[model samples]
Target: MKRLKQIVNELKLTQAAPEAALMREFIFYSPKMPLRLHQEQLVAASKQFSLEVFDTYFAHSDVTINCFSWGNGKRKVLLAHGWASKALDFYELIIELLKIDDLEIIAFDAPGNGSSISEFSNLMLYAGSVKSIALNYAQPDVLIGHSLGGMANVIALQELEITPHLLISIAPLIRLKENFEQSLDSVNIGAKHQDLFFDNFAKEFPVSASHFNLTNLYQLSTAIDHFLAFDPADHISPYSFLKEFLDKYPAIKSKSFEDVGHYKILRSLEVIDDVVKRIYALPML
Candidate 1:
């Protein structure tokens, strides 16, 4: 990825049209890594307990979202997976949550992700898809999001009028600017294209980088319980980002794990147990 970015950066310096094309490719490309054999087994195991499983399509203005749901409990729990991943990434977590009575579990393949036909998607698109699902299907009592989905959920909360009973974010991407800068730096994109990148990005998305801050949308009056669990060793979504939120929202319950890292943290039995315990710990609402 770094080498590809470096090549794009050089092309940007040399020509205008090719540079724009390269930039578009960088912005729109979605990795298509399929679930591994073990992951497939986990997903298969999870499916065994589902009361009902079916596919549904949601048409948002420009994009069509394809997603699936498991269980039929009155109380809904929505799960959003991260980039380069499908809803099945949460198979283990879903499996554990299924043991809980009166809880419906829904997971979706976002546009440009998983089985969805869309070829590209940004944060705004992901957030919009989330909001559409919440409003059109069921307003989730418990909202669980991992990685990029976690960040999109934060943005979705801003637009969603319904306040969930609990919001659990696992290894969430917190700072947009920091992430963007790191991506640019990784590809050795210099000062000029860095400025150009943000400018072009702002034009493409509905929300600006300045408005993407989750802290601005979070409120104590929202009357929602929040739980954040992140592995301190996680490099993708740094522990420091979660720590920043912890410092700001003292009421937010959090647990830090040692060796879980980013992806494994989702599948960890210990983490799944912790999440289930947290959900059950909450008083009936």
Candidate 2:
């Protein structure tokens, strides 16, 4: 059964590249199909949290960004969400950090995802979306990001010329190593064939996408949906998104974890607490 699954997955990859991109957009861009999180959980968790969520324009691009703060303070903490995810995705962790009376939390949805704009065509456009958001809320003592968000933050900081006192990245895509980079545009393993990735990993490698739940699958599907509009074939490989974005290399330092796919990396309470401690420990200026 496993061998047969692998064969089927490979065949799908071989056949899907040309049209898979279009099909992906059809699934993701519907106004009725926008991705959402558990609203009650987000709202109930945020009471007395001094939350201010709104949309603002940055460089004329409408950005959906939120600010959560407690008490008056000069310090600002900005949280960036991963690809295809919204600012609310960080609500759970943001609530935890809001307990600190002297701190502020802000998060934003990147372009082409969530309530933000729906049309961005390249890595620079994605990074610029971050820059536009950052300019509106630049009072940062620290910057936190997960996976694609982390990478975008790096690019945004450079583009906006904004610097935070501390930078923390969780499972960031600073580099993809060699094998994953090589596989990006491979005729047999391109990004367009991600629907078959689970089966491919299960049968070809020892990994199974089933280890994750429906939420994870939904987010992955969202990412595929957005990538479809970009016509990834025009670019070298999806790998170049990171390479091109990182060419200048911002000064922030970071730590990464394995075994945690992008979404799981942001869901860690440990990371949230660690970030709070680091921000609080910074010297008052």
Candidate 3:
């Protein structure tokens, strides 16, 4: 309250205006983690596997994206990193993929994430970046995504020129609108500013709030296998909500682990093994 009032007073702006400004700032970033602290990890991981870095133009902006690739197998596996994370964050997972004789691994950082350059980012921008990366690379035979990256890969299934043979989603965002609203509430903005913020949000995004979720957008062309791995105890992407969402589609194959949290699920050897096995299990397309 004090900081909000101070900003409002200093700028001679209404309380709602400052809250709206804050809402815009938070809405773009609340769901994603920042990667500055992980710089050393990215640097050291880049040294392994003789990574090949390339650039692509993100679909939503005039920004260049950093893409990573390794392995020399005929089958291409594309890895999409979540917001605020880079391609090398999956160093362990990449190591497992490298072991496969027939797999060529590909991964990329979305604009403003990792080595990619951009001033800011949003879900739509990230999704657009995913689409751009898929088309730039040879269409991937296997697609893997984590968190926001998982959601982006799902969106890729809809937007890509060709559908992948296998899709793996790890704790994707179930309903981004609900999460965004909760983020708004956390900032202690009153209802009026919230309304104003959303009104402008709709104008800027030009899409229904309901459209950004995983449920309504989740689909793959026939013959595509899907795997989902997530810890039900995850607080970031709540297990109960994921359960209800999963319950609606019983055919989807899933594995549950407890206490690994949202991000560590990526690092879990069990997850890496199962994911590798599934990729090998995928019928060559």
Candidate 4:
């Protein structure tokens, strides 16, 4: 991916037509990384608990997206995984959520991730996919999203007409422009290239950088119960971001863990229990 970005940077310097195309490709392309043996085992084990597992496809913008679901319960729960992650990343959560007799679990590999065919996807695409799935495929009574997925869920709630009775975000990415800047800095991309990237990104996404924020969206009035869980040690999606949200929505139930970072938080027993407790505690809607 860094090489691709470097190529895009070189192409941008020339202002060539293919430069835009390559930039788009770089933005959209999500390379599939092989899971470790333990990770594969976790996914395999999670599948065992599924009463049923099936694939479904949906259209987001011009792309067709593939999604997978497990369990068979009247009350539906939609799980959204983070960037470069598959539905199986939420395996631990799926196992715990299944404890609820009437709860079904639906999860999808966002475009460019997992089994989805699209080469690239952005936060807007992720949010649109979530909204499309909720409206057409399954209406979720409970929505749980982790990291980038959590950010997508927040955007979905803001733009979509339907709202889940309960919403849970685990280590959500906030501060859109800042995150983008951080990403560019980490890659050592030049300031000129960063400007070009954001320009292209804005054109493709069609949303102002100012609008791509959870802090701004969370301020809107909503009766849906919100739960946020984060660890201060999370370096990717800083705990400070979560802190900003908590400060604004003090009514939101929250949990802070010291040991777990971004990825492992999904698998932590304490986090799972807290998530389950929130869902089970929700009055049937």
Per-model C-alpha lDDT, please?
A: 0.72, 0.47, 0.70, 0.73
For lDDT, candidate 1 versus 3, the one ahead is: 1
Model 4: lDDT of residue 161? 63
Quote the positional error of residue 69 for candidate 3 in Å. Answer: 0.4
Q: Write the per-residue lDDT of candidate 1 for residues 97-158, one digit (tens) a residue.
A: 88888787887777777767665666666777778778777788888999888888877887
- TM-score, ranked from best to worst: 1, 4, 3, 2
Off by over 4 Å in 4: 1-27, 34-61
TM-scores, one per candidate: 0.82, 0.55, 0.81, 0.81
Number of clashing residue pairs in every model? 0, 0, 0, 1
Q: Which candidate would rank higher by lDDT, 2 or 4? A: 4
Residue-by-residue lDDT tens digits, candidate 4, 1-285: 565557657655554333545544554466565667765665554432111112222233366566666677778898988887878778778777777878878887777676666646677767867887876777888889998899988788777766678889898888777776675565455577667777866675566565777877764345768888898998888878778878887888788888999889999999999889888887765
User: What tens-digit string does per-residue lDDT give for candidate 3 at 1-285?
Assistant: 243344434334444455555566555532334455454454445423222222222234266666666766778888887766777778789878877887778777776676666655666656666676566556788889888888878776687656677888887778777766676565556677777777887776677566776766766654567789999888778887788878877767899978788888899988999999898787664
Least well predicted 10-residue stretch by lDDT in candidate 1: 49-58
Candidate 3 collision pairs: none
TM-score of candidate 4 relative to the true fold:
0.81
- How do all the candidates rank in terms of lDDT, highest first? 4, 1, 3, 2
**Local error of candidate 3 at 2, Å?**
21
Worst 10 residues of 3 by lDDT: 49-58
Higher-ranked by TM-score: 1 or 3? 1
Q: Write the per-residue lDDT of candidate 2 for residues 1-285, one digit (tens) a residue.
A: 243344445545555453543322322232212435574355444322212222222234443333333335567777776555666777667777777666666665555555555443223344555565455444566777765565566666655565566766554444422323233334344554555443444453244534321112122111110110111222212324433433333222333333444455456565566666766667776
